[model samples]
Target: MVERQEQAASDAVMTRIGQSVMLHHAGDREEARGRLLDLWTEIGEDGDPLHRCTLAHYMADTQDDPADELAWDLRALSAAEELTADRPAGHEDASAARALYPSLHLNLAADYAKLGRREAARTHLRRARTAAAALDTDTYGAGIRTAIRRLETRLGENDPDDPRSGPPRQRS
Candidate 1:
């Protein structure tokens, strides 16, 4: 009964968050972030890590500096790591939670690049690629492809003549 009640509460939270997402997509960032913060507070400490990570990302995206973005990305990555660690050994493939790792890598890479840490940026890009490869193919496969392409573009290894938009992916 308690589990069901908790699930219901979670559902309500997700519903409200979905509304916030809609607001965010419509350019009402301030409103969305405000609602998001309210929801974050409601979720409490033991709430879902994914939601927390998402809130962090949203907070950063709505911020000014790219370093602020990196901060949120790092927090999300830490949450993903914690989620992975908490999973039992047998079902160690709790990938939906871990998908945040690659995003963190990408964000960190971008930050390093902005700060002129070329080697560090490349290293972070590679780390992102590695994290992406470990993701579940059935779900995050497309995201992994996107991340690889983005990393390739960042590394300047991509051909300028390539038709690809954002990133160039070297398919394995």
Candidate 2:
């Protein structure tokens, strides 16, 4: 069992990390990205792959350079795959990973489309739709649904094609 002293130290470390994350989120993209990279390195491969995956997604979205975006995607996808493999079956992390897989696939498909890999893009898009449909209130559920709807709409397939694709949500 971990000693109380050690546990407390770990808690302190996490608290500091959490504070840093909050600061970043509070109107500081440059600071946030810098801090995120530092935290990403500090946490290493052991902390949270999904966290890294999310960070990578943000990085990819913000990177103006195509090559850098691709690099971020590869890094995020690698982390997600590795973490998912290490997690036990039916574990919450694994379940979350399953739910998030569609977004990764969708992003990959977009990249493939940009690269003119039509076949690969189509294959991944199909996987993304399937995974998104299987999701149930995952953190990425709404995003997945939105993305899937957008993709379908692009192919001339959103059922209503209304301003709001799905039912309304409580305004945050």
Go through the candidates in order and give the clash count of each: 1, 0
Say which candidate scores most in TM-score. Answer: 1
Per-residue lDDT of candidate 1, residues 1-172 (tens digit): 9999987876787678788888888999888878877876886656677566666656656556777767766776666667678776454334656666777777778777877777888887777777776776765667665866776676665533446653565655
- Candidate 1 error regions (>4 Å): 44-47, 89-93, 135-140, 157-172
Candidate 1 has which clashing residue pairs, if any? 149-167
Off by over 4 Å in 2: 1-28, 45-48, 137-140, 155-172
Writing each residue's lDDT as its tens digit, candidate 2 over 77-163 gives: 787787789898687756766766788778866776666666666676777777777877765688787776776555333334345
Enumerate residue pairs that collide in model 2. Answer: none
Worst 10 contiguous positions by lDDT, candidate 1? 157-166
